[model samples]
Target: MATRCDAIVIGSGQAGPFLAARLAAAGRHTVLIEREHLGGTCVNDGCIPTKTMVASARAAHVVRRAAEHGVTVGGPVGVDLRAVKARKDRVVAQSVDNLTQWLTNLPNLRLIRGHARFVGPREVKVGGETLAAPQVFINVGGRALHPDWPGIGEVRVLDNTSMMTLETLPEHLVVVGASYIGLEFAQMFRRFGAQVTVLEAAERAVAREDPEVSRELQSILEREGVAFHFGVRGAKVARSADGGVHLALNAAGVAREIDASHLLAAIGRRPNTHDLGLERAGIATDARGFITVDDQLRTSVEGVWALGDCNGRGAFTHTAYNDHEIMADNLLAGAQRRVSDRIPAYALFTDPPLGRIGMSEAEVRAMQKPALVGVLPMSRVGRARERGETQGFMKVLVDARSERLLGAALLGIEADEVVQTLLLAMQADLPVSLWRRSVPIHPTVSELLPTLMAQLKPLEEIPR
Candidate 1:
């Protein structure tokens, strides 16, 4: 006999908990199933833990550069990696515990700890019991891809999740993949006193961005003592008797090897949908194994939906949370919200983060719209200069004829927060003409945005 519910939510990821809460509050009996920790990847391995350690790394960096700011320390700055790990663990634990408590206490909701495999379109089986529902939501999220690259079986490796368990910093950390996750970890470990090397299959650091963006980011990482070897499609690894890792690489046909203390395979992420028995539920997945969802995030099956990383629409935590908002609004409030309504916005966490929104320069150029571009270096920003952290640039694009904001890429001190000013204007459909006229608070990084707008030129006039 199957236990019936009003709705069954799979995976307690970014979208699941809040959506389940709303469903339960509306008098539906909601069952949320999980196989592991609460709050999914962000609270466990991805955002919270990584950012906590990034904060520790940043602290170490600030202390190392204290001499530049005329702050004299009595002794050499040293990082306690164990202490850093402990602090991260504590913060993560607090978050997980709080979320777990709230979910368990949610009225009309049942928090089930088990793996859910869909037996039908609107029903799932967890452990020895079957759960049937009229509606089902899948938010299973994703995990780091452990590729069958050469010699992968020979050496111990760390992905994003296992890397968090590190209590000691690596002497030399070789990170595979030069995208956001890989670069962030490379910089973080480098700041924690690891000699870091990054290997990318592409010619550039972040291949998806504008070539200039990639170049500047690579330069920043290089200046921070992180080595890069790009255009490497394959690598062979082995562990020595002394516990050191040896990586043999071929970058554009030139072969090289790196003897390092650790290896991190930050290649990519695969959706957690593999084990969910989507075929049994008659659900459709993309070639990459991501759940296929429409604009409203509905799956192929009736009354089924997928959200967050598993849906392939977006990967960031913010996107997943927004997915929850969209799902809730559409289901509960009768609004016709959509996944397409979202503008792409995310920040890369480096020493100085890169905040990006909307189309890239390449995308804008391909669109062939008459666009105006504005560029500014961090050196010119008052706050960046005053903080002695001027090391990047800001670039924004606008549709020339309409004067509407198009896109922005900010890479510098407080760039993550600074880019929001442009994000809001773009989302609100505010024109750059009016945006530039407003007086912003003086001496801040964002105030320089208006100054940036004043320097707009034809997009083609700007060199990437």
Candidate 2:
């Protein structure tokens, strides 16, 4: 016999549990299904675990730089990989436990521990039981993309998830991609006393950012002993006789080889829609397998919605959480919220993190939009200099006609948090003059925002 419910939430990801809670609180019977761990990638493998490890890496880096801060350590700083893993495990476990407890306590909500597959437009099969509901929400999330490269299947390689489980640090870590994920791990392992080399197929690391920002970021990482090979092509990997990994590639028409103790492939991510049986539910997906959804996160099929990375909209946890809010508002509160109304925002958790909101300078130019731009180095920020961490710069862009803030890229100490203020300002549609006139607290990295805005010049005035 099949169980009937008012709603079905597939995959206990950032959007699933919240949506299920809202439905259950309204006295609707809801069933939330999960085949693996709760909290999806964010708690199990992605954000929570990686950020916890990044924090440990930052501590190690700070200890090594204590002398520059006038604090001397008697002995050489060393990283115990086991201890770091233990701490990360504890944090992840606690988060999963909290979510599980909350879901269990919710009335009219059944948390099913099994894989779910669509059997009809409004029904799914989980283990031996069948569930049917008028409303079904898919939040299955995504996983690391594994590219089809020669010898990849024969040789051992680590993805973002598997790399975090390592108990021993590699002597030489070769990262195959230069995206945010690759760079974060590259720097983290480098600070843990590993020789890290990052290779990117593009002309620069983070191709989406302004060329100058990419160059500056490369310089900062290089100063920390991280090697970068840009414009690489025809890359292949194989096992060497010394039990290490051998990577061969061409850069600038010169062929080279890299022999490393470990290789991490941080190419990208793919949506988890392969086994969902979306066809059974008549849900449309893109070429990349991401579910095609409307601005309100509704699929082509009625009563079926897709959220999170699987939806091909936004991939960040915050975006996924907001998806839940949008759906809940429309379904429960009679409020009309949409996925299109969000400003793009995310952070890279490197030592000097990169905080970005809205479009990048390159993106703005690609749209052929006339804009005014401002640039400020972290060296000019009193807090960065005081902390002996002056390594990056801040940049902002404004529409030439409206003088309204369009985007911001902050790459420095606490840049992640500092960029949020600009994000909020952009969201509020504040004018450039407002940012220029606002007085920020002294000796802070964010205080330089007003000074940066005050120096805004025509885009042409700024050097490429």
- The window of 10 residues in a row where model 1 has the poorest summed lDDT is 233-242
Model 1, runs deviating above 4 Å: none
| Count of clashing pairs, candidate 2 | 0
lDDT of 2 by residue, 270-343 (tens): 99999988998888888999999999999999999998889989888999999999999999999889988999
Predicted structure 2, TM vs. truth = 0.98
- Residue range 346-459, candidate 1, lDDT tens digits: 999997999999989899999998999998899998888899999999999889999888899999999999899889988899988775698988889988888888889998
What TM-score does candidate 1 get on C-alpha atoms? 0.98
Clashes of each: 0, 0
- What's model 2's lDDT at 144? 89
Error of 2 at 404 (Å): 1.0
lDDT of prediction 1: 0.91
